[model samples]
Target: MRWEFGSILPPEVKYNLCEPEILWFNKYSKCLANYMKSIGDNHGLNLTQDSKPPKSLYIEVRCLVDYGKFELDDGESILLKKNSQHLLPRAQCEPLIRQGILQHITQ
Candidate 1:
């Protein structure tokens, strides 16, 4: 409730749970992948075909003593650590991107 409408919102408050909103990110990620690859191809840089599975990004609870946005579902979930990282690198994102790999993004 600390955020105002249309304001440049800062990071979520401590202990903020963003998993509920993850669906949005999931869709966005796929779309973003497509857009990024297309742009790369248009520029003659995206043409590599990555068959690896996408990576999942989540927060490590045990590590964060403050607030967290994601919860890792790796077996027994842990609490958010203060120094937690929310973004997991897409394993195939860079290599394929750098190799100019392109594929039809599907839902």
Candidate 2:
């Protein structure tokens, strides 16, 4: 039941994912995707769709601040540092890119 690389919801960790929103972040996912979908429907939040931007972009960090760690789609945790370059979904990195913390690198 080990999770494969790039898996956000691995089989073993699936059942252990849920947590109380107030204690953790308001984010959540259920063991049963259908049930989660139904709950989202009741709450008016669509769970099934391409939530990220269609296009991704590569970026290079420019500042010395730690932008925190990001779990990449490839199942790697990156501690973004100055002069580090990474490819990330635009939607996910938009804020940092806008704040001058990261500079876009044309591919």
TM-score of each: 0.24, 0.36
Instruction: After superposing candidate 1 on the true structure, give the runs of residues whose Cα lies further than 4 Å from its correct spot.
Output: 1-20, 42-107
Candidate 2 regions with alpha-carbon error over 4 angstroms: 1-65, 71-76
Identify the leading candidate in terms of lDDT. 2
> Considering summed lDDT, which 10 consecutive residues are worst modelled in model 1?
1-10
Which 10-residue window of candidate 2 scores lowest in summed lDDT? 21-30
For each predicted model, how many residue pairs clash, with residues at least 3 apart or on different chains? 20, 0
Give the alpha carbon lDDT tens digit for every residue of 23-98 in model 1.
5545655565566567733533322333344444321112224533433323444334455433322432343224
Evaluated at residue 10, the lDDT of candidate 2 is: 51
Per-candidate Cα lDDT values, in order, are 0.38, 0.52
Residue 3, candidate 1: Cα error in Å is 21
